[model samples]
Each structure stands twice: as C-alpha cells, then as structure tokens.
Target chain A: MHFMTALRAAWQQRDSLLCVGLDPDPARFPAHLQGRSDAILRFCTQIVDATADLVCCFKPQIAYFAAHRAEDQLEALVEHIHARHPGTPVVLDAKRGDIGSTAEQYAIEAFERFKADAITVNPYMGRDSVDPYLAYPDKGVILLCRTSNPGGSDLQFLEVDTSKGRMKLYEHVARTVAEDWNASGNCALVVGATFPAEIARVRALVGELPLLVPGIGAQGGDIAATLAAGRTENGTGLMINSSRAVLYAGKGEDFAEAARRVAEETRDAINAYR
Target chain B: MHFMTALRAAWQQRDSLLCVGLDPDPARFPAHLQGRSDAILRFCTQIVDATADLVCCFKPQIAYFAAHRAEDQLEALVEHIHARHPGTPVVLDAKRGDIGSTAEQYAIEAFERFKADAITVNPYMGRDSVDPYLAYPDKGVILLCRTSNPGGSDLQFLEVDTSKGRMKLYEHVARTVAEDWNASGNCALVVGATFPAEIARVRALVGELPLLVPGIGAQGGDIAATLAAGRTENGTGLMINSSRAVLYAGKGEDFAEAARRVAEETRDAINAYR
Candidate 1:
C-alpha cells in the first residue's frame, strides 16, 4: 500500500493524530526498570502497549537507541510495534543525509534493515542526497522545514533570491519539496508545532501533505494553534509527536497506566481541535 | 590534544593529505571474503593496516557499517586505527544533524561511542542543532559547504542576504563557521574537490580553517586543482578523501597490497601539488 494512504487509513481507523516518540532514555527510566539490560525495550513496549490505540504512528529517534548501544533493541521495538498494531506506522527519526552510494546505504539502513514505514532526513546536501530515499515509493521521507529550536533561524531565516522573489530558506524548502521533490507523493515536511504561522504557511504551500510536528507537550507548543494551522480539509494531516511527556508521564510502578492516561488526554485534546 | 592539532600533527608525520574512506560494502567485497560474516570488519581493517602509513587520516562512513549491521565492526575498526597508528585521525563520516537533547545523544554516539576525532554534520538546522557537537572543544565538526555532487547546487548556490551583503549560501556557511561558529577552533568545511573554483571560493571565505575534500577518486575531481585552491598559506589545510579508488584497487588475495599502492600514488599526487 502507498505510505500516505496507509497513514490516512491509520488516522481514520484510530481517529487520532498523536505520534508517540519512543526515545527511551535509560537514565530517565522508572526505578524498577532501571538496572535491567532490556529496560529500553521493556519500557518502550509497555508504552507501545498502552498507547497503540491512541496514536496515528510511532517515531523512534535512532540516536537514543544508538547512544545506549542498543540498535538491536530498536530493531526489536519496531517489530513489537508492527506485531502489536499493524495499523500504526513507524518513522525512524534518523535525520540522515549524504551523497550517492553512501545515501543509498543509509536508505537501506532505515528502510531495509530497520523496517521503518517512513524516515526523517536532513536536506542540507541537496537533491541527490534525498533522491535515494525517494526511490522507496512506499516509504515516506520527511524533511525539516521550520524547526522548533530557538537557533533554527540561524540559517533557516536567511532571505534567498528565488524565482518567486526573496523568501526565507525554510519557505524555499517547503516550495521545493511540494513541487519538485514529491513526484512519489510520499514526501512530507517537518514544520514545528511551536511555529503555528510557519506551519500554516508550509501547509498552504504543500497542500494536503502531512507534517510531523515535534514541539508539543514537553516542548510547550499550543495544541489548538497547531491543529488550526496544520490539519487538512478533512481534519487529519499532522503527526503531532510528544516524547518525554508521554514516555515519562510517571515515575512509579503504575507508569504504563500513567502513560496511557496522558496519551488519551493528549489525543482527546488534539481531537477537540480537529 | 585538540583534533585540529592532532590532524596537523598527522600531516607533519605522514607527509600525506589523503583521507582513505573505509566504506565497507560486502557485495563489492573481493571473492575471498564475499560470503564471510566478518567480511565488513576484516575488509576495512586490512585497508586500515595497508594504508595507515600512506594517509594522514581514515574516514569510516557510518552508513556503510550500519547498513550491514556491522556497527560493532566499526567500533573495533576505530579502536584498531587508534591502536595501529595513534597519530592517525579517524573522522567518522556521519553527517548527523538534530536539535537540543537529541543532538547531545548524537554527540555521544560520534565522540564517545564511535571514538571519532571528527564527524561530518549537516548545517541546515542552524546553530542549536550544531551547538551540541561544537560543545566538544577537543573534537572537530566538519560541515557540508559546497558538495561535489551535481544536485548540491539546488540550494547551496542561492544568493542569501547576509550582514556582509548578498552571498551564496555556501559562502555564508563558510563565513559563519570561520567567524561565529569557531570560538573553540574545532570547525571545518567540506568543499568538494570536483569544484576547484568553489574550493577556492570557500578557502577565501574561511581563511585558514581546514577543508575535508571528497570527490577525489571515484567522483572525478581534479587533484592538482583541488590542492591549489584549497591549501592554506602553509600548504597543509586539506584532507582529500578517496574511497572506491583506494578500497577496490584490487580484487584478489593481494587486494590490500594493491590498495596500498593506489593509496600511496594518490597521496603522492596530492603532495606534489601542495
């Protein structure tokens, strides 16, 4: 099935736009699960079990797993997500970009080895770097547009001379991705939830393409504003990601229960706006 | 010791600016090691041992290792590089980019986990995404400026309005890294060996900061032009990279010897221009 179509199916089936980011930090794990070697997988699966019904997808940031030397755990976590909820998509947040054969290797790593339905990429290296990922027609490629970080404007805000006159770098990225880069119809843009106006601008440029928003909950982005700017005409086109807030909702024995509670609350809040 | 200081030491000791890339691909491996599970590490370590004396540095691209689940081999290879020739710098060609805590995790992955002296990164996200990597004062951060690939001009050549007036995106990146982002003096720019003119442009922009030059071997970049345009006043400011031409120099049992022969020839060719 086409990745975008699958995602739309997931949105209708689950009736949610929340994407739980499985960024398992061992240091922040609850007390009982702290010392175990399988804590990363165990903690993540418990959350996955608790929140599978409340999300459109699951995004696992590769750095978190790679930092702990647990690539194997990440592999397992993705398998668990697939087995538990075949409807939920997995977007590996690798942010990888390179040229030629090296980019091909990264594409293999994200799609073939890790088995992600989609992956986020950095576009700094230009078209050939991203072309390899686009070759995977059934997999979505999300490029960073206007990021939520304060220092995001360092290069993103630079006014560049385009054919359509002067525009910000991020705006150029959005226009480029929407037109030239989305021949496969599997391309998505990552517009931050914190910047609702930029998100809206990106939406206007990209049409009905999904946006993988990252600055919600712990990052302090407004839910209503994000939905008002990001939703498609049918009211579902944003994969609003909340990691630390949902994963570390409680520090006690009933941590999974607390995670479920927060997941549903957040889901309902997002739905209220929709 | 600082990474830049160490690389300079390598230039003096080895008398070569060649950075042989260890991007191990099993399908391309010689007949003897074709089906071997240990092929990735074994192939790479032989390349390391063969050319350790001929080159100033070794760059093991992480995507190649991760694609084949040979990250452990990459870890061992880095240790081997350090153990074999303590003076040789390992620049892990991981073009990583992210923001905040995620960026810190990537920092740990590159410096702590992989133990690379330097790592390549994408500059699209601006300061905060790169700040975590820059925080490691003793390590080097190589940002993509003017890449060799054809698609690199898609955005890099855009004239951006900067404080110094309108300049190409790559020029702005070169200036920013040289002036603002190098308080710790650990930043370097990657200007393709293919575009000797752009290399000269970047060199003029960034002054004496080093440039990690790719596009030398398989990418059809001119060695003499690269050296002339990229060298500093002292004639030792470029780390010219060659992967396929050096790695696949031979296809037989004596492949390592052929690799050494090609590596030495390439190294000497680069030195002649310098």
Candidate 2:
C-alpha cells in the first residue's frame, strides 16, 4: 500500500492521531536494556507490539541510534515492527537537510537503509536540499517550520516582508514548500503545538497539506488549542507527536503496557476534537 | 592545543588560508581504487601526504564517507592524516543540527567518532540545538549562513525585522550565533563565497569569528571578490574551501599529485588576497 493509504488505515483502526516518538536515550532506556543493541531492539519490539494498536504511527529519532553506530540495528528494528504489523507507518525523525548530492545520500540512508514511510527534515538549507527526499512518490517529507524548543522563537517568528505583505518567517517557508517544492510527491510541515495562533496561520499558508504537530505532552502545550488550530476538516491530516511523555511512561518491566495507556489517552484526546 | 591556537599555527606554516575538501565520490574515485574501503583510505592518505604542506587543513565531507556506511574506515582515515602530519586540522563537513540531546550525539560522532577538529552545522534548529556542540571547548562549530548552492538565495537572503534593526535572515543567524550561542567556546560562521556583499555584511556583524568560506573552485565564485568581502583586518580568520577542483584533479594513479598542484595554486590565490 502507498504511505498515505497505510497511514489512513492505521489512524482509522487505532482511533489515533497520536504518533509516539521512540527517541531512546541510552540513559533513559529501561535499566535492564542499557548498553545492548539487542535489548534496545527488544524493548522497541515490545513497545511497538503494545502501542501499535493505539498509535497512528511510530517515530524513531535517528540520532539516538546513530550515536551508538546502531544505525543498521535500528533499521532492523523498524523493519521488524513493519513486518509484525504491516499497516503501521514509521517516521524516521532525522532532521537532515543539505545540498542536492548530500541529500540524495541521506535519502538512501532513510528510505533504503531504514525503509521509513516518512522522515523529518530541516529546511534551513533551502529547497534544493530537500528536493531529493521529496522525489520519492510514496514517502513523506515533513519540513521543519516552527520547532518546540525555547530558543526556536529566536528566528522562526521573525517578521519578514514578502511580495504578499509582512509575514512570519515560517509562513514564507510554509508557502514556499507548499506551492513550489511539493510538486513531485508527499510533503508536510512540522509546526510546533506550543504556538497555536502561528499554527493556524501556517495552516492557512499550507492549505491542505498534512502537518506533523509536535510539543503536545512533555512540552506543556495545550491539546485543546493545538487541535483547534490544526485539525483538518477530515480529521486525518495532523500527526500529533508525543515523545518522552509516552515512551518513558514507566521505568519497570510493564513499561510497554504503560506506554499503551498513555498512547490511548493521547488518541482519545485527539478523537475528542472530532 | 585549543582550536584557535592550532588553527593559527597551521595558517602560518601553510602561508595560505585554504582547505581542500576530500569528498571522494565512489563514482569519481580513481578507477583502480573503486569498490575498496582500503583504496579510498589510501587515496585520502596520499592526498594528505601530498598537500599536507600546501593547505591549512583537509575537510572530508562526511556525507561521502557516511553514504558508504564506512564510518569506522573514515575514522581511521582521520587518524592516519593526523599521525602522518601532526598539526593539520581535519574539518568534518557534516551539516548536522537537532535538539540539545541529539546534538550532543552528533558532537560525539564528529569529535569522537571521526576526531574532527571542527564540524559544520545547520543553525535552523536554533540556539539550544547548537549549544551542545559548542560545549566542547576545543571543537569548532561552523554555522551555515549563506551556502554556495545556486538556490541558496531562496531563504538566506530574506529580510527580517529584528530587535536590533532590519537584517538578512543569514545575517540574523550570524548575529544570534556569534552573540548568544558562543558562550561555551569555539564558534564560527560559514559565509559562502557566492554572495560577496552578504559575506562582508555578516563579517561585520559577527566580529572576529573565523569564517569558513566555501564555493571557491567548482562553484564559479570569484576568488578576489570573496577575499575582499571575507578578509578580517589581520587576514587570519578565513578558511576558504575547495573540493571538486582539487580532489577530482585526475582520474588515474597520478591523482594525488594533481590534487596537490591545484591545492597549491588555490592556496597561492587565497594568500595573494592579503
């Protein structure tokens, strides 16, 4: 199945718009699973098994694995999850952006090495840095517009004069990516949930393109406001990501089940918006 | 030695402020050296040996090595270069940026995994994302401002309203990075040679921070104009980079010598700017 169709099916079956982020900090991995790639893989396996029925997708932050040079192992873990549950999409959270040649290599690493359905990318390097990734018809490229961190506001919210009028920097980025660089295939914007009004404004610029909304749980963002600003008329275009709040739900052996509970709560909250 | 002192010594010895990039594309690797990691390592070793006295540094584009999953071999190549000629700094050209936690991992990968004295970074993720890398007092973080690519003007030259005054987006980046994010230690700006006036303006904003200027040789940027725009009063703060022009000098066994000749010529052209 194509990525969008598989994403829709998973969202429908799980009744979830939540995307659980598996950014396994070695320091935060269950005590028993520390320092072993196999244990990390198994922990991811159990988490996927339990939360797979509750989340629309899983997003594995690639740096956590890359630090240990466990890139291939993480690739296998992502593949294992898909093999076990064929319809759940995986979004590899690697914020990569460079020139065209380098971007092509990164595309190979994300799509061929890891087989991710979608990938997060930084848009700072300009449109050409992202073209190689968006060239793939079945994959999704979520451009970083406004990030969740405290310092993100330093530059992302700067007002700029465009041909249209005075606009937020992110609005220009959203307009450019939506209208120009998104022709060949799947493209989405990453708008932090912390800024609800900006989210609505960016949504206006992006029109109908899907958005990956981060900062809902651990980042202290209001779910109601985020949903109010970001929800599409069809209720399927937003992927709300909750990382530490869901992944580190429990420190003990029942961690996977605890993750499922958090996932369920997140899913229910998103569903309430409908 | 600290990065600044080390860079200073290398600059004096080479009598040139040039860095040759070792981005060995597999398709462009010598025919005799194709399909072998050892051959690639040997190719890099000979280039270092040949141009060790002519250039200030060697910048191996990490994507070229990373694309092959030859991370360990690349690490070995770095060690080989340092051991053969002790004072030459290795600049790992990987434009990495993410959150604080993820950024720490990239710092480890560049400073520990590859042992690069400096690494290029994307500033789109904001201050916290860059702070982790800056925490390493001895390793330099080169922030991407105006890149050399044809489409770089898409976002870098954006006019933004900031608290200080009206500024280009990249100028804003340079100001933020140089003023706010340079607290922990080593920091530099990447001002591409493609935009001469922006380079001069960013240099004025950044004030004395080293600038790693790319886009010299293969990118059609005029060397004399780049020198006039990028040079500090002391003429000691620029690391001009040339990759394809030097690395792809020849396709045969004589490639290393050809690389050295071009590196020498390029170095002379840069020194003439003073």
Candidate 3:
C-alpha cells in the first residue's frame, strides 16, 4: 500500500493520531535485556505485540539502536514490526541529509534495508540533499523545519531576504518543498508542537502535505493547541509523536501494559480534539 | 597529544593546512576492488599509506562507507587509517548532533569506536546537545555555522532580533558557542571556504579555534582567498578539506599515487598563500 493510504488506515482503525516513539535505550530496557542485542530485540517485540493495536504508527529513533555496537539491530527491529503487524507504518527518525549522491544511499537504507514507510530528514544540506529520498514513490520524507528544542529558535525563526521579499527561513523551506520538490506528494514538515503560530503558518504553506508533530509528551507541547494549528479539512495528515512519556511509563515488568495505558490516554486526548 | 599540537606538528612538517578527504564511493571503488569489503579496505589502506606522509590529516567522510550495506566496513576503514599511519590524525566527517545523553554515545563512537581525533557536529540542538562531546579534552568538536551549500544562506544568514539589535544567525551561533561552550578550547567552527567575509567575521568572534573549511575543489570555493580569510596566528588552526579533487584524481590502478600527487599540489596551493 502507498504511504498515504497506510496513514489513512492508521487514523481510521486506531481512532488516534498518537505515534508511539520507540527510542529503546539499552539502559532503559528491561533488566534481562541490558547490553544484549537479543534482549533489546525481545523488548521491542513485546512492546509492538502489546501496543500494536493502540497506535497509528511506530516511530523508532535510529540513534539509540545505532549507538549500540549492534547498529545492525535496526534491521531486526523494523522487520519485526512489519512481519507481525503488516498494517502499522514505521517512521525511522534518522534526520539524515547529505550531498546529492550520498543522500541516495540513505534513501536505499531507509526505504530498502529497513523498509520504513517514512523517514525524518535534516534540511541543512539543501534540496539536492533531499531529492534522492523524494524519488521513492511509495515512501514519505519528513523534513525538519521548526524542531521542538528551545535552541531551535536560534536559527529556525530567522528572517531573510529572498526574491519573494522578506520571509522566515522555515517558510521558504515549506514553500519550496511543497511547490517544487514534492512531485510525489510524499513530503511532510516537522513543526514543533511548542510553536502553534509557526505551525499554522507552515501548515498553510504546505497545503495537503503531512505534518509530523513531535514534543507532545516530555517536551511539554500543548496537544489541544497543536491540533488546533495543524488540523485541516482532512485531519489525518498529522502524526503526533510521544516517546519517553509512553514507552517508559513504568520501569517494572508491567511496563508494556503501562505503555498501553498511556498510549490509550494520549489517543483519547487527540480524539477529544476531533 | 593535544589536538592543536597534533595539527601544528602536521603543519610544521608539511608546511600546508590541507587535509585530503577520503569519500570513496562503492560504485566508484577502483575496478580491482569490486564487490568485496576486503578489497575496499585494501584500497583505503593503500590510499592512507601513499598520502599519509604528504598531508597533515586525512578526513574519511563516513557517508561513503555508510552507503554500503556493510556498515562493518566503515569500522575497518577507520582502523586501517590509524593502524597504517599512527602519527597522522583522522577526522571522521560525520556532522552529528543530538541531546546531551545521546551526544555522549556519538562522542564515544567517533572518539573511542572509530578513534577519530575530531568530528563535525550541528549546534541546532543547543549547548546541551554539544557539551557531552566537549567533555573529552583530547578530541575536537567542529560545529557547523555557515555551510558551503547554496541553500546555507536560507537560515545561516537569518537576521535575529535580540537585545543588542539585529544580527545574522550564524554570527549568533558563533558568539554563543564560543562564549558559553568553548570552556575546553576543543570547540571549533565550520566556516565554509565559499563565504570569505563570514569566515573572517566568525574568526574574529571565536579567536584561534580550529576551523574546518570544506568546499575547496569541486564546490568552486577559492583556496587562496579562503586561506586569507580563515588563517590563524601561526597558520596552525585551519584544516581546509579537499575530497574529490585528491582522492578521485585517477580512476585507474594508479589511483593512490594519483591521490598523493594531487594532495601534494593542494598542500602547495595552501602554503603559497602564506
């Protein structure tokens, strides 16, 4: 299935916009799983088995797994998700960007090796850095615009003089990606939930494209306000991500179930906005 | 040895600030090394062996090795460079940046796993994101400020509204990282060789911190002018990088020797400015 259809299916079945972030830190894994790649795989399997039905999608922070000497484990993690729950889309949060030729390899890694339905990318390298990823018709690319971090304001909010008159740097990014590079309609913008006004402006620029809204949980971005800023005539384009708050709900054996409860709450919270 | 001392040693011996870049593409790996990791390893080993004595440092662009499914090869490539040329420092060209805890893992990976003396980073995540890497007193952290890409101006040149007045965003990043985060003197900035005035301006702010100036050969950045703008007191803190111009100088069996010749020429080009 195409990424858009997969997203629509997720929104309809789970009745939630919640994307459970699986950034499994080795230290945070269950005691039995510490420092062992097998154990890490097992923990992810259990989390997927338990909460697979509760989330619209699963977002795995690649750095956590890549940091371990077992960078190869990322393949197992993504494959496990696809094998058991074929309907659930996976977004690999790699935030990768490089030169033209190099970016193509990352596309193959994300779309071919891991088979991620979507991948987050850094736009620092410019449009050519991202063109290779956009070539994949079935996959989605989430471009980082205004990040959830406080220091993001240091750069993302800067105003510049373009041929189109004075414009915020991110607004230029949104307009270019939406109008120029996104021929396949697989482009998405990562607008932090903390800044609702900017989110609204970016949403207007990137018309029907998807918006991957992070920072709802530990980042303390207001969900009601975020939803109000991002939702359009069709409200399924936004994928709200909550990582630590849901995944590390309880440190004990019932952690999976605890995760389920928080996932449900987060789901209800977004649904209430609808 | 301290990173600055190592840089100075390479400079005094070679009388050049050029660091030859090794970004070998798998498809372009000389015909003899096709389809085999060991062959690629051998080729890189020879490249280091040939060019080590002529240049101050070797920068292995991680993206090339990472493009292959065999991520294991990237580790071997790093090991080969260090094993063959123990005196020459290896700069792992990975522009990595994450939160404090995650940044620590990257630091360990770049410094310990790969044994890189320095690595490139993005400061968009703020001081906390970069502080973990600076904890290692021996290694240097080269933060991206004004990049060489065409779209770099989109955000790097943004005019910020501040207490003092409006200032370019890259200027703000330079001031903040230098004043607040440069406590260890291991912190540096990547001022693209393409932007000479920005290079001069940022140099004034940071004061003698190492600058990794990329975009010399294929990217149309002028070597003579860049050296003039980015030169330090002793011509010791500048590590100007030239990748394709040196490494891919010849596609034939004599590629390594061709690489060494070009590297010598590049070293001469920089020294001529002094």
Candidate 4:
C-alpha cells in the first residue's frame, strides 16, 4: 500500500495522530520480560498489541534494537505489526542520511529489510542523500527539520541564504522540501511538537504535508499547542510520537494494559484538540 | 587501546594511511560467491584478510550489512580484523545522528554491539546529539563537515554566522568541532577528498585533529591534492578511505587479490604524495 494513502487512512479510520515509538529499552522492561532472550521483541509486540488500535503509526527506533543485537527481532516486530494491525503505518525512526548508493542501502534496510511504511531521514546532507528513499514511491520519507533538542539550534537555527532570501537553516530546509524536494509528493517534515511556533512556521511553508512531531510525552510538549500550530485544513496530519512515557508506563504484569490506558488517553487528548 | 593511539600506531606501523572500507554489495560479488548464504561475510573477510597488513584502519559501512540483514556478519568481520590484524582500528562508517539516550543506543550499537574502535557520525544536530558518543573517551568520533557530493555544497557552502564571522556551514562545523566539541580530544572531521581547497580550509581550521577523507577511488577524487590540503603538521593525521574501487576491483577467483592490489596502490599513491 502507498504510505501516504495508508497514513491518511490511518488518521481518518483510527481518528489518531499518536505515533507510539517502539524504543525497547530492555533494562527498563517489566521484571517478567527482562533478560529473556526475546525480551525486545516480546516487550515491543505487547506494546503494539495494546495500542495498535489507537495510533496512526508505530515508530520503531532501530538503534535500540541494534544496541541489543536484536535487529532480527526488529524485523520480526515490523512483520508482527503488519500481520496483526493492518493499516497502521510503521515509520522506522532511523534518522538515516547518506548520499547515493549508501543512501539506497539504508533505504533497503528500512523499507525492504524491516518493511517500514516510512522512515525518518536526516536532511543535513541535502537533496541527493534523500533521493534514494524518495525513489521508493510508495514509501514515505520524513526529513528532520526543526528538532526538539536544545542543541538542535546549534546548526539548524543558523542564518543561511536561500532563493527566497536569508532564512534560518531549518526554514530553508522547510521551504526547499515544500517547494523543490517533495517531487513525488511522498515527503514529510519532522517538526518537533515542542516547537509549536516552528511547527506553525513549517506548516505554513509546506501546506498539507504530514509532520512526524516527536517530543510530546517525555519531552514535555503540549498537544493543544501542537494541534493549534500544525493541524492541516482538515484538522489532521501529525503523528505525535511518545516513547519513554508510553513504553515504560508500567512495570508490572499489567504493563500492556497500562500502555493501552496511556495510549487511549493520549490519542483521545490529541482528538480533543481537533 | 585508545582509538587515537591505535590509529597513529597503525599509520606508522603499516606505513599506510589507507582506510579500506568494507562495503559489500552481494550482486557485485564473484559469480561463484553470488547466491551463497555467507557471500557477504566470505567476500568481506577475504578482502580484509587480503589487505589486513596494508591499512591504518578498516571502515565497514554499516548500511551494506543492515540492508542485507548481515549485521552479525559485520560483527564477525570486525572481530576478524581485530583478531587477525591486532593494531588496525575499525571505524564503523555509520554517520548516525540523534539526541541524548537515542545517541547512547547508537553509541552502544557502534562501540558495544559491533565493538568498533571508532565511528563516523553526523554533526548536524549539534553538541548535545554528539555528546553520548564522545562519552566513550577512548573511541574516536568523526563528524561530517564538507561531504564529497554535488549536493553537499547545497547546504554546506552556504554562508552562516559564526562567532568569529560569517562563514560557510561546513566551516562553522569545522571550527566548532575544532574548538569546542573535541573536549574529549576524540573528535575528527570528514572533509571529502573531492574538494581539495575546502579540505585545506578544514585542515587550517582544525589544526592537529585527524580528518577522514573519503571520495577517492570510484568517486573520482585526487589523492595528491587531498594529501596536500588535508595532511596534518606531521603529515600523519588523515585516514583516506576508498570503498568500491578497492572492494570490487575484481569479480573472479582472484577478486580478493585484486582488492589487495587496489588497496596497495591506493596506500602507495597516498604515501607518494606524503
């Protein structure tokens, strides 16, 4: 299925903007699941099983799996998401950026090896680095624009000359992606929910393009401000990601239920703004 | 061993500044090796074995392995280089960029999971994103400054306000990395070999720091110009990498030998300039 189509369908059908980031930290796993050989997979699949109905997307951070030597489990987790919960897009939170054939290899890692519906990519390398991912017409390519972290301003907020005149580095990225880089219309911008004003600025630049807004739960971002700034004309188009807060919501046997409760509250909270 | 110490030792001991990049593309393997389950590992280890004595460092492009779900092979390949060629440092050419704990996960992925001596990272997200990698005081962190592609100049060459004065984006990264981000004294910059003048500029900015110069071999870069522009005060700081040109130098029974020949030529060509 086309990623954009799937994403939109997920947004409408599920009535959700929530994107649960499956960042499986095995050390923080419930006592029962911790140290199990298949802990990362089991913990993540349980999370998906709990909140699959409430999210527009499931973003599995790859480093978490790779760090644990559980990439095989990540492959299985994505397959699990597909088999169990149809229509929910799986965005691999890889933030990969490289040029030419290297970029193609990464695209294959996320799109082919893991079967991600979309992937988050770094845009600092410019258009060429992202072209390979864009080549997969059905897959979504989310470019990092204004990030949530404080140090994101170190380079992202610098003034740079654009065809439209001097603009901040990230603003230039936003305008470039909105006007020139979104050739196949399969591109999205990662504008952090923490930066509501920047999100509005990005939304203004790239009208109707989806935004994967991380930094909501553990990062202390408000859904109200985010929705006010980034919602499209139809009051949609944001996949607000929450990782630590949702994934580690509980530490007992009822962890999955605790995850579902948080997912419900978060999803409904997002809809309240809409 | 400290990555910097190991790197300098390998440079002097091997009398080669060449960093042979292990980027295995299965389709490009010898006809006999093609379709074999262990083709990626077999081909890469053969290349490593062939050139183990002739390199300062061995850089394995992580995407090539992850794309093929051969990350375990990558682990074994790194182990092979370490066990077989004791002094050669392995710089995992990951180019990963993220914030905080996510960065830690990537650090574990590179430093712990693959047991790499050092890793290449993207500096676009700034100091905070790179801090976790720098936390491993002995491991080297190579940050992307000016890349070796046509699109690299798109953002890299743009004018930006530095504390010193207005300069190019890449120059800011070079300067920042030189003065501030190298507090651990484990940081290096990737100044692509394609642009020699820019390489000189980066070298001038970051005095004694090492530079990982790519874009040689298949990328059509000039070694003499690169060496002239990027070599340190002692003429021993750069680890020049060549991937495809060396890795696929032959496709028959003599493929490993062909790879070794190219590796020798590249190392010799680089040393000739020095």
Error of 2 at B208 (Å): 2.0
Backbone clashes for every candidate come to 0, 0, 0, 0
Candidate 4 per-residue lDDT over residues B153-190, each given as its tens digit: 87898999767999999999999999999988899999
DockQ of each: 0.84, 0.66, 0.41, 0.83
Per-residue lDDT of model 4, residues A56-90, tens digit only = 99999989999999989999999999999988899
Rank candidates, TM-score, best first.
1, 4, 2, 3
* Chain B TM-scores across candidates: 0.99, 0.96, 0.94, 0.98
Residue-level lDDT for B103 in candidate 3: 74
Clashes of 1: 0
Chain B only: TM-score of model 3: 0.94
Model 1: which residue pairs collide?
Answer: none
Error of 1 at B258 (Å): 0.6
lDDT of 1: 0.92
Candidate 1 stretches greater than 4 Å from native: none
> Among the candidates, what TM-score does chain A have in each?
0.98, 0.95, 0.95, 0.99
Output the better candidate (1/4) by DockQ: 1
lDDT of 3 by residue, A1-274 (tens): 7777888898888777888888777678767566564766777777878888888889987767666655567788888888989889999887776667667877877888778999888776677778888888888888888777776675566675566677777787788789877888888888889888888998888887888888888888999998888887766668899988887887888888888898888988988886
lDDT against the true structure, per candidate, is 0.92, 0.83, 0.79, 0.92
Residues A22-56, candidate 1: write the lDDT tens digits: 99999988999988999999999999999999999
